[model samples]
Target: MIQKYPVGIQDFEKLRSENFLYVDKTEFIYKMADIGGYYFLSRPRRFGKSLFISTLECLFLAKKELFKGLYIEDKWNWEQSNPIIRMSFSNIGHKYLGLKDAIDKRLDEIAEEYNLSLVAPSIDQKFKELIQKLSAKRGKVVVLIDEYDKPIIDYLGENPDKAIENRDIMKVFYSILKDADPHLKLVFITGVSKFSRVSIFSDLNNLDDITIDSRFAGCCGITEEELADNFVEELKTLDKQEIKRWYNGYTWDSSTSVYNPFSLLNFFRKKTFQNYWFETGTPTFLIKLAEKTQLYDFSEVEIGANALAAYDIQKLELIPLMFQTGYLTIKSYSPMSDVYILGYPNNEVKKSYIEVLMAAYSQSDLGYGVVYVDKIRQLLEKGEIERLEGILNTIFKSLPYELWQKENEHFYHAIIHLTFSLLGVYIQSEVQTSDGRMDALIRLKDFVYCIEFKLDESAEKAIQQIKDKGYLVPFSAENKKLVAIGINFSREKKKVEEVKWEVIKA
Candidate 1:
């Protein structure tokens, strides 16, 4: 069978008609019909959210012809289709700072089709006028707004006052949702960030957020089952190891152990599994947020609800922003402490994020392609602690002063192992041992080295954790010497505070 790849394309009908690769998420359609009147999904860009929204649009518009051979092809009742009002805010703020002018232009593109002349000066007025007319004419309206937070997010940092201005304007306009609830059948909205509930849904009391709801987990990204089942043919054309390493770590509620929709398609189309999503755009907002917070070593820190909840994020909501914006995701949720473990969604995100972080700090992207094995070989063969420490120190110094937790302490200690592996160093993070997690394990050229890093803790503690936990117990008889290192970091100092190395040199 010929393989199909949908790359940089979000339109549902087009993809369906063109016979592009499609992972059937038609189940979400009926689920949507059961959920609350309005829906909100927050995921990182290029996660197939736009396409999902488009699918919703097709369903609402009763375009059943496009869903043939899909899960929901025969499940939906086409007779109940409603008129969908779709709007995208990609180029929203070019002419309007207030909702009035910005929305006016958008209304002119969509609301004009209703044969209604919207001359309202404010967004609230224009929205009210359009909804009233559209509802009165069609009897029901299905509102699907894509990238609903784009205007606010794009305006931010570039111009905060304007974002604030647009926020208030959106408040008034969207408030009509409550006022026009009876006339609206289905409302689906998507955005990059989950802003204050007070910001967008002032009156959207029925807004249902299925973002983390385990039921609708597979609504956006491709699932592992879906990828394996559907894209197995495509997989045959790519390097299996590289593909998995780059795109396959995300496990959303079990079913979503999958590839990045964007990167997956791009890989098939371009015949390479490069950093497609990361190269698509630089998350300047996230970089700025990190710098502004001086949050050194983001990877090393264990974050919680206060970190993920959009409701309490103060002054840009960096952690919460990271979760919603796609840099991190809930890996594990502990009920006892109500703690959630967040990390890169997949190998693709991990590699891309590291590249971006490296570039931000060092003004150069770490060529994380394959040299990692070589680095691991060298680091372990000669027990080159200085070489590894020196590379990290130089990169850590490249970090802007604002993001410096401590000038001498490198914030990247969290991923020193991941970094080396990313560089093809063949290292592992949090490797298991009878003593404890070896923290890191580097293997290359038949040689293995166990490594550990600690900050605000003694080298003895770092090494002892390995000893107490028996972290190095796994490689005792692997035909090679086992190396262990406990490195301490000083936040105020920003570099390696001390390095204590011990090797079971053969």
Candidate 2:
């Protein structure tokens, strides 16, 4: 019998009581309880953080019946029950409503739940009193905060000043955890981004950030083994490799690769390959930041793991925003240099980001971009170089004037990169060759396109550079037709000016 897929079900008791399919992560949850007093985990939104927090609430409440046959049933102590002080910032409306007001209302509800008298007027003071009162009356308090950064991240784009103010308020609110350590049993915080030490967690200095810790890397996401073991019936009819290609590349460390839990569950239920998670929350602020900066290449972004965690209201680096928010993930890591190479986590993110970027930068609808990408693929497969040139020209000319007002090769490279990648074809940009680097290389089953792009120069010069630099030499071993194309973008005209090509049998 196939179990019901728990899509959008954040309540642990409800999920288990309804006989929903659950990938067993209780082993890691048990381990976390044993190891740390205060913990923080940074995962993309809807990656099972809420459900995990709910599960923690049940465990602390000693709801042992819920964990009947799970991994932690025998390992956990069922006699000990703590008063859980659950504070969720997940569904707060802080855009129009005041954030402080929201916190006060939630605190009021919590105080009433525990039947405690609140003397403090401020939100932080109320939180402190709740912990102290709960510890004195029942037992030590277990605090689980879900989406702790939502108040700040929600207003980051619309009102940055509001976001910063929220950040300061949040800092004071969380600082109580340190002072109330004597009354706290365990504290777990989950959010989308990990703000730096000096920013959000400055006062709460004892937070064990298990974001990149290998031991708990598989805590939040469904692993390959978990998927295969739990969904045996689903695998009989599905293409496993295709599923992996679409949703299984999010990694916090080099060792473990996890499937996006939200997308994977939806894929099984819908029986379709779609950008489920990306569509749910695309982060428009991030796409706009990518375009405005034009300062760096999104296709070629590399930063150390430490750099990826340094995000705050004031410092909005595109790399950290993308990396932490699930657009980009760890492609590889160099222990020697202590740097991590970040790229699109899976095909879903790659295609969705291109669609979003195209719409935002080119002022075209997503459907238009998809149709044009299909046209580009057809032209490339049939070796229709001139028609491909016309499509490129049309695409560039259609872009908004504000987009191309500044002349930056990185901007052009990013646009072209998105265009080809959206075609759902194999592509590599700025590929290194022995002599020099190739601007773009596209691969088809029967043909390969060695593309050289130049700005404010003749197409002939671009073609000469491809040959002079021996960019096509790497493809000599493949027994397919090699097509060399040189394209020039006129900075003055803000459009493609020339295209030259030659197809040679390999």
Candidate 3:
């Protein structure tokens, strides 16, 4: 019999009662509970953060039947149970009611659920009253807040004033936790972005931020071992490496990479490898920020440990935003300098992101961008060097006239790089040689194309530069045929002006 996979299930009790397949993350929960304290975790959206939050709620509520065979079943004391004030910000109607009013309403609802009356007038006062009352009535309370940054994040790109207003509201609201610490058993907060404590959790200084802790690095995502253990039958017919390429490689620490839980589960359910996670939400703000900064490449991005925690709404940084939001992840880390090397976590992210960038930069729809990439891939695979000029022209022609700027060359090169990079082939841009740099190099099965681009200059000169710089010298000994192509873009015409190529027989 096949197991039921929970594709979008976030309720732990419902999942367990319905007999859905669970990844058994209770061991991490056990460790966290055993060393109890206030904890904050930051993970990308759809990484199972909500489900983990729900699991914690069940554990604290002492739902022992839900944890029958799980790792924490025998370890936890079943006799002890605490009152849980679980609140998820994502569904709290913050947009319609305003942040302060919405929070106040939610607090009132929680108090009513616990059969208590909170006569406090203000939001923070009400929260403090609820905590104190709950602890006084039935021991200490376990506070679980999920998507704590949603209210602020939802308004970031649209309304800065609203975002800041929400931020201030959260600051005062969370400040209640500090004074009510004596009544709190364990406080676990989860969100996508980690605003500095001084901003949101200023008063709650004792909160332990385990966002990058190695011990809980695998807390939210599904590790390779977990995948193998949980989905043994599902892996029988699928290519493991391909699946990993599409959905794996997300890591907080340099080691212990895990698969995107949403993507992995959808892959098993649908039996198709599409952009499962990326399709759910497009990073429109991040894409615009990238375009503003001209940050098309993330291959060599590095930031210090302090930089990861340096998120500010007033002064938004692109790299850290992308890293915290899942566009870029830790590729490597230098302990000596406390710096992290960041890049696209997997093929799904890289391909989908470049497609979005291509569409945005070219002022075309996503369908056209994907079709353009397919056309380019087909032309390159057939070694039809001549036809590539027309497709390249179409790509540039799609760009609006006003979007062109003084940095025409950079714009043109960015489109070209994005085009080839989406092909999922071996491609390198601005490759350095002993003498000069090659514009682009594409390695196909039977042909290695050394490509050079020039603005206003003649294609013959562009082709000659490749030869003069000995750009093909490195690949000369390979078994494939060598081909050099020069493309010249006309700034005046705003399209590809000429294309020239020379085939050197291998």
Number of the top-ranking candidate, with lDDT as the measure: 3
Task: Report the CA-based lDDT of candidate 2 relative to the real structure.
Answer: 0.82
The list of candidate 1 runs beyond 4 A from truth reads 34-36, 92-99, 119-121, 237-242, 251-255, 311-314, 362-377, 381-406, 410-426, 431-439, 452-469, 486-502
Q: Ranking under TM-score, best-scoring first?
A: 2, 3, 1
Question: Which pairs of residues collide in candidate 2?
Answer: none
TM-score of each: 0.84, 0.93, 0.93
**Worst-scoring 10-residue span by lDDT in model 2:** 424-433
Clashing residue pair totals per candidate (backbone < 3 A): 23, 0, 0
Question: Of models 1 and 2, which has the larger TM-score?
Answer: 2
- Model 2 backbone overlap count: 0
Question: Per-residue CA lDDT of candidate 1, range 375-493, in tens?
Answer: 54566567676676665565456556665534333445534543554543133444544444455666645556566677777777777666666666666778776666777776667
Model 1, C-alpha of 349: deviation from truth (Å): 1.8
lDDT of 2 by residue, 299-377 (tens): 5577976777777677688888888898888888999998988888888888888888877666777656787777888
10 residues in a row with least lDDT, candidate 3: 423-432
lDDT of 1 at 50: 84
Superposed by TM-score, candidate 3 places the C-alpha of residue 440 at a distance from the truth, in angstroms, of 3.8
Clashes of 3: 0
Global Cα lDDT for candidate 3 = 0.86
- TM-score between candidate 1 and the true structure: 0.84
